[model samples]
Target: MATQTLALTRLAASAWGCSVRRAKELYTKVIRSVLAYGASAWHKVADTKKGPALSLTTVQNSCLRTVTGAYKATPQCYLETEAAVPPLDLYLSARAASFEIPTETTGKLQLLRGACIKAAEIINRERSARRRRQRRPQGATSETPVTLWPSDAQLASAKQWLGGQTVEKALKEKWEQRWFHAVTPTRGRRELAAESPPDCGACHRYDDMLKHEASVLMQACTGRIGLRSFLFTCRVPDVPTPLCNCGEGRETAEHLILYCKDFKESREHLATQLAPNSLRTRRDLAALTTKKDTARLIVKWLLRTGRLPLYKRAMEVGGPPEHVNLFRP
Candidate 1:
């Protein structure tokens, strides 16, 4: 119980932008995940009669390798441990080398511990090398720096970041570079790259709102419009707007889709399709569902499914919001 509690405490801290009411809702999910893994591990070690009695180090070592497989399934929970744990270098190396190391089905905590140790060593070595380079006389010319542009894959990712294209060919190439690139002091041009089905650039507070908007778009468009159905079959071209609206700026999803005159035509077109009769009085579709039940259904439809055109269209016009589309191919 203590082990799982420790894990959730770490998790709740990282789940940014949750309301106290919403946080209670989210906690059940977090607790379930922490307990699920802990329960599974406890069961595996139950015969030893050491389930609740294991040390923290023992628990961590048993959990690390399985952590990858679990992460691939329950990503949100994986994120809870992100800040407290070392980078999962063993997992990375396993991907890089493409070789499997046998782990005890009994548990993966030890494997994780070893991986963590190795990650620490690698980090230490890299830091030492960096200090050595810094100590060298300033007059010495450093090795010629690489000014590589995006490869085909990287270029596709770059385009995706720019909110342009999402061909499978393009996405595959972009991820290939993303998987191998070294972190440098200088930020890359495409650092802010986030598109639907990949990156979601929205405030945590507004994530649910954006999702509701997508559903409303989808529900309204699918039956009456051809564009919505077409988007259901294809990837929408993304338009990356990297400008931040933090300092008296107003380029958020609400501003773009509802308030901004730039998207007036598109918004009107959608409003006409979704709720044409309601369009005259409804200046803001988002504002229409202040009632909890209506809002919940809208959010569910938008965030959970891909049948609607509004969902994909919003994704194209707006960078990915937190309401994720699991159906995108």
Candidate 2:
């Protein structure tokens, strides 16, 4: 009985290593090796004067059925936590060599092993189903998908960065450090890509760089100043004026800023009247802009903003003598 129990334990260990679904497939391979060698050992022991009277073939079939069914029903993948192992006594015992068994019993044991393995598999599956229902957490609805939220650390970091005082100044400084004023590369060619889309200003000029720059400074001022003020500082014009040479129609914002004939003359007169020190450096008139003083200080503001085209044109062709709104005496 000890030997038989030991043999059964060894069979269970082998079966536990393989899945129930694949038990028969692996059993076929293992059975051949067991029969070839195990049968002789079984025969030698059974033929001993004191040994059990079992046939060599019978013992071999019994071992095969036990090992295959035990492994297949409870595969090793699921049994790692269970602290069970095979018995060493029967596994180490010698088998009888003289005993023999009918071939019919051998075939029967193979079939019985496969069936027992299948039964054990169904039992394991049913147990797992019951455990799942019992282990589910409360308040978690089947319809809701599991989701993860940002940690408290992440939310705190976001608030800290947003609350910092240096963000605006840092942004301005970063932009000022770049190379070109506004141009950027286009696909496959070194063409100007619009970092900012072209906008139609009151001046009706396609290139509205002056308005764009002034707008930025205006925003920095928190609405204390406006576009009109910025324009006046540049000496463009708060209101439209007619063209100088022809009495055709009233001039537009662009005319006053860059196209006006008299606007140029006024700027030149103011330039000559400036102090010697002021006339020499770019820093002297750097602060005043269109928003500074539109009506009275156009020339001073225009000088600061770098709109010299209208002035140059006026210098080349004399403008009306009375049209002197840009420069004050």
Which parts of model 2 have CA positions greater than 4 angstroms off? 1-141, 145-148, 151-170, 173-260, 263-265, 272-296, 299-329
Candidate 2 shows a clash count of 25
Clashes of 1: 16
Measured against the true structure, the TM-scores of the candidates, in listed sequence, are 0.21, 0.20
Counted clashes in each candidate structure: 16, 25
TM-score, predicted candidate 2 vs. hidden true structure: 0.20
lDDT of candidate 1 over 160-193, digit per residue (tens): 3424333333333343344334322252111111
lDDT of 1: 0.33
Across 1-329, the per-residue lDDT of candidate 2 in tens digits comes to 33653544443332122222122223334543353354323322211122332333344444433432322222221111011111111111221111112112256435545666677677666766765878868665543222332233422332342244343332233232221232334321211111212211211210122222222222211211223433343455542432323243233222333344555666565555542323222223322222233312433344343333423343343323334422111
Model 1's C-alpha root-mean-square deviation from the true structure amounts to: 22.3
lDDT of 2: 0.31
Estimate every model's Cα lDDT from 0 to 1: 0.33, 0.31
